[model samples]
Target chain A: MELPGIAFYIVAFLTMGGIYAILCLALNMQWGFGGLFNAGIAGFYAVGAYTAAILTSAGSSAHLGGFDLPIVVGLICAGIASGIVGWAIARICVRLKADYLAMASIGIAEIIRLAIVNEEWLTNGSLGISRIPRPLEAFYSGRAAEVVFVVFVWLIVAVTFLVARRLQQSPWGRVMRAIRDNEETAASIGKDVQRFRTETFVVGSVFMGVAGALSAHYFKFFSPDATEPLLITFLAWVMLIAGGSGNNLGAIAGALAIWAIWSLTEVVTQQLPPDWATRSSYIRMLLIGLLLQFVLQRFRSGLFPEKSPKLRISREK
Target chain B: MIDFINFYLIPGITLGSIYALGAVGVSMIFGILRFAHFAHGDLMTVGAYAALTAVWVLGIPALAAIPFAIIVTCLAALLADRLFYRPLRDLPTIYTVIASFGVALILRSIVQTVWGTDSQVYMTGFQKPTIFFDTFRIATRHIQIILATAALTVALHYFLSRTRLGKSMRAVADDPDLAAVAGLDTERIIRWTWIIGAALAAIAGVFVGLDTDVHTNLGWNLLLPMFAAALLGGIGKPLGAIAGGLIIGIAEEACTYPFFGDTLIAPSYKSAVAFVIMVLILIYRPQGLFRGRLM
Candidate 1:
């Protein structure tokens, strides 16, 4: 490919990877730090994307739209919307076992997808609520626009990464890890384990919502198909797990790596005839699944497992 | 009244039976294996396709292909146990569940690759429902599904409660440490559990193909509902799965009841009903209606 073409594709891929990295960090907060198994990652993501779209889109008047809100307000509200939904889910599912929590999470995601498909008033039905405002699009176009979006997404990713890092080093983060390491012990020591877990879940969901809003603005066009579990939710888990569950930097690395793999697989599989394309994609899915297995078996702590604070402190002494 | 039975009751029972079969397998795995088998639904699809292939290659009828498919699924389950579950035995339950999710994706992709995305029917063309009692009606396939579920349930009950092997299996589920200490072959018992549970999942998938159509996503769509059934029926009790499946199946159909205090709900919302019930059960009755696992 020519330099300009390559540059455009690279910019596009980086923006997507940055957006995914934000999501991975959010998930790490729940699964890694809080020991919560949130399988319904896509539901919170959809909540963010749709909420932002509804708040900002000028064309959507029949439903909850035409507010024409600023992009920042829309983005913040998207986060709030996702967090609220996560809080509700946490109330019902947090007391259950790990397996049950996972089940409820996946169920919530499917329900969200179904609701989006059916509720024309809320989501514009299957046609999907388009015309979501893209930030800074007035000044840039084509390759330039995409490059600006990449910078825009990276700014958000960097901010989220810093906040997540601060949280990881805080006493609150210690309590979170304590709960994950041993819930019984944490409870015995007077920690409100369940409450903290719920908080972590909500906090994590906020970032997911932010990522969703970013994704919506980037594509400027999305349908229910964009929220499919295989493409969005499961991929997030794979990124988090492959990168090192508790490590933020690892999350970023995993996001880029997995996104690369995803796009490359599509490119490789696209060579097939029209009839065989579907089969090839399935084969690609199979490969991705096997890759996850390999990662789980070999890299149990993930590629960049969490650094033990205690170990670091003692070593310094 | 006949319309209610024909539209809701009959379809509910048929769906319930399919779920009951898969739920039994899921519940058994949770009880004995002590992890949620995420791949159970995909395995069901694999079984259906296996049977579909048998019918195609051997030029046999649909019903006749079932046994061969069951055997193949059994072996597949055994292979999965050895290849996936065995390696992660010592890990936490969550890890095993994640592994099962991986297995599910793998199985689904294989089905998509081999069968392509187009929906397939075993007999092609719809079979008209047969009238019963001059007022009630159900398709012939529905009756077969109900009868087959009943037979499987009875046989499973007999084995679990009556035969020595069945008792031993129950004993293992109740207290694996004790069963192991008492000289029972726990590994062999687990192997049998996988074989039986997986064969049952296969039959459920095949029955679905018989009633509706076979597609790559068939089992994926059923995964959550059957899980709800298994959880509702209690963790390990096969009988509970049947009852739970029936309730969930019926509840799903009723979710679209045109009048909801003068409001309307689309039928597309039917699937969410199962999920809502599952969440409620997890909150209010985690031990399940059958009182199996204490969640």
Candidate 2:
């Protein structure tokens, strides 16, 4: 089995890295900007992916497959659906204080995964939908197409980062920060805490949904198995936490760093002696766990701390 | 209908008992510590494996090995709390939550490294299935598990309500600062909390292993259900935890029944069923079914 070309691998890495960076950014917005600990982002991501796959797949009855909608539309639809779900969850759960919110989000995520698994009519059950259409297949060809798609995804990342940064600086951003820092004080200042949280959650989930859609198109195949809470969800959390939670750039950096590490470990394992290779996957998990522990212990602020806001003085006065 | 009741109801209760024991441990820890310990499931796995090792490798009797497993698990929990959790206790609650994940990862890795990823069954084979009249059948092992859980729950109730140490535990759960001011040794209470909670978790693990195959992922699978139970019973309430566990257990089993003709939900959806129940409870009554204090 010859390995794919280096360019192919690079494109794959960049695609995954970009998608994850988008997810981390979403999480950073919810967790860092809004101080919502969402343990269920993977659920939304999976939902987005499945929604796109089911809607766009060829030859399906009852479900909305065979539409062959443009990739941009599919991506947008994914974001809308996830945003709606996130809004519903927020409305129900935003009132609950910290820790309970985490538990609730985790519960919701598990439920979504179960729904994907059980709702055979809609999600194709455990067999999972495959042969998803690539977005730019008609316009571009071959590896160059892949390279273009990577750039396209990075463009999404760039826009998302810019938007998140803008939101973080706006008045609404200040309100969100205030809520994160102290809800009572924010409320005292006439802020609708729940509304802010709900909006933030919806917006963040939209990004997650878009990321999921992008990822599905890149992979060209998807399964309910991909949506399982443990693998994708936890890894994203690990990335956001490793980077500064509030910093979009840091989230991207962390995604790239972790994905590179993960890819490098996989490659290294494959090259190792056959006997050692078998256990390398478990070793990787252990290392990740250990890395999480070390990071949490040693640098609680993360590699890139969220920069303090710049203050301006009235020099004219 | 009678057959369905006989088949599913009793088995569900037995399963519920096991979950209740695990949830009780989780509730107690959360009540006192004020953070969700994600590693609790792995601790359950460790406990089950510890007992398995004692029986299979060390040649101890199954009955004797349980106590050993519980002790070992308790010690491990205590050590983890002291080394990993204690330092971060003063940090942000999120830090503790993250640390729990780390602890879970580390424990899982250790288990995999030592036991390998392959599933293990307790060496003790079934002696015989109990005959309950002519229509119903029950397993002797399950009967033992249910009875043992009841006994433990009762003992725990008495210990918490009647005994001096139990009162201290409750005091700490209510308000650690006040309890400390009241001259209760808060640190000792915490240590004992981990010990007892871990011991109960170990018992649940052993019971689960007896009922089904034991694997590294067993604890991980149990985590959500345990949380459901704890949340349903009202986060820090011990009795609520037990009740919540039983309810979730029965609900999970019953959900497997065919709702519409020829459309039966699979047992794999048990976790999902638990989550749904939990979400409804959370949405309507965030304080939980029992309305106990938040952990």
Candidate 3:
């Protein structure tokens, strides 16, 4: 690839990596901390994107696009909408076993996808929401636009990372881990296991929603068809697992590394003949699938395994 | 009224049988192996293509192609079980489920890349609809599906009830440790579960393909409905799956009636019907209608 092409790819990679970073962080909180096996990451992410799209776009009759809200408001609404749905999912599904949770979440994701496709009045059907009110819209284009967006995504990731790190060190975070490791023990200690799980799920989903909103605004397009639930969910899971699930820094690294590899595959696979070119993406999917199994079997704890927080003898000042 | 019966009822029975067959595979896998087989749908797609190959490519009769597809798909599923599922069997349920999802991805991609993403048929060119009493109308293909599914179900029922291996399989599912202590080969039981499950799944896939056109994404598309049927029937209960499948198949199409109203929801939203039904079931009876194993 030429320098400009390389630069463009890097920018694109970071922007998506940043979005996935947020997604991974959310998933890390749920799976790593709370031990909630949420297979519906795509559902929550889609909710966030669509919520942002509906809120910020000016009303038109192409489907049902008349929110015309401010960007900040749109993003927050995305988070709130996602959180609300997540809370419901948690309340209903959290008590189930980890594997069962996976099934139920898949169902949720499927329902969301169907809704996005069928409910034309709410989601604008398949045409999708475009001309999105991106940040610094008039002030930049092309490379400059890419730089600004990457910076914007980086800021979000940074803030989110800090929040997640802080949470990891907090007493509540400890409780979440406790519940995950031993639900019976956590409950016996007078903790409301279900409530904490629900709260953690909501928090993670809120972050996911905000990330989705940013993704929408950056791309300036949103649609149900664009979601691709299973792949998106699997991508986040693979990133978190590859990063070392409980480690915050590892999540960031995993997000970037996995996204880069995925991008490289897309680039390299483009040189195939037309017939092969049409199907190369599926080959990438096949690789990811095999890679997931290999990692799970061999590098179960991931590259940066979760640090078992030491038993601290606290001396309150 | 006759339009409704012919259009909805006959189609419903045929669709239900397919769902039941797939759900049997799902519930059995859940019972013995103890994880939701997410790749079961893709396996069904594999069966469809195998049948397509048997008929369209290999010049086999359409009817015989069903069993050939079942055998071929079973072999592939068996290989997948050994490579992916068997190793993770002793791990946490979550690990196995994750592996299964990965398997789903791999299987789906295999179908897509190998088969190409085009609609195909085992035998094309429409035949005249067969009418019963000049009111109950079903095409030749539909009758074939109904007979095939009924035959499979009866065979499955006999296998589960009258066979020593089936009895042992049930014993293992109930308590693997005790069954092991009682001298049953746990490995063999697991193998049998996959065999039966895969066979049933292939049958379902081929039947569904017969009803419509075969697509690489067919299995992925059916995942939700199959899972819903399996769950509704109760996780480990074969009978429950059959009942659940029938109800789901009927309800999915029937929802376009006064319940949703045609204006309320398009026919394209048929997939959502199963999801909604599953959610409602989970909300009320997470153990499922048959009161099967919750886990």
- In the order shown, the candidates' DockQ scores are 0.81, 0.60, 0.76
TM-scores, one per candidate: 0.96, 0.93, 0.96
For model 1, how does the per-residue alpha-carbon lDDT over B1-295 read when each residue is reduced to its tens digit?
5676788788888898999999999988888888888899998999999999998899886778899879988988898889888888888888889888888898888888888888887877668878888887788899999999989989999989999988988887777789899999978888999998899999999999998988888888898998899889998777898899989988887665544453244688888888988987887888899888754
In the range B105-171, model 2's lDDT, one tens digit per residue, is 7787788877788887775466676776776777787788889988998999999999999999888
**Candidate 3 clashing pairs, residues 3+ apart or interchain:** A59-A65, A59-A66, B233-B240
Model 2 clash pairs are: none
Docking class of 3: medium
B20, model 1: CA deviation in Å? 0.7
lDDT of each: 0.86, 0.82, 0.85
Per-residue lDDT for B156 in model 3?
78
lDDT of 1 by residue, A1-317 (tens): 99988987898899989999999999999988887888789889999999888888786565767488888898899999999989988988777777887888878888988998888898887888788778887888877877788988999999999989988888889899998898899899999988999999999999999999998888786678765666677788888899999998889888999989988999998998988876887888888888888888888778788885552344553
Candidate 3 residues lying further than 4 Å off, grouped into runs, are A273-275, A310-312, B258-265
Better of 2 and 3 by DockQ: 3
Q: How close is candidate 3 to the true structure, as a TM-score?
A: 0.96
Top-DockQ structure, candidate number? 1
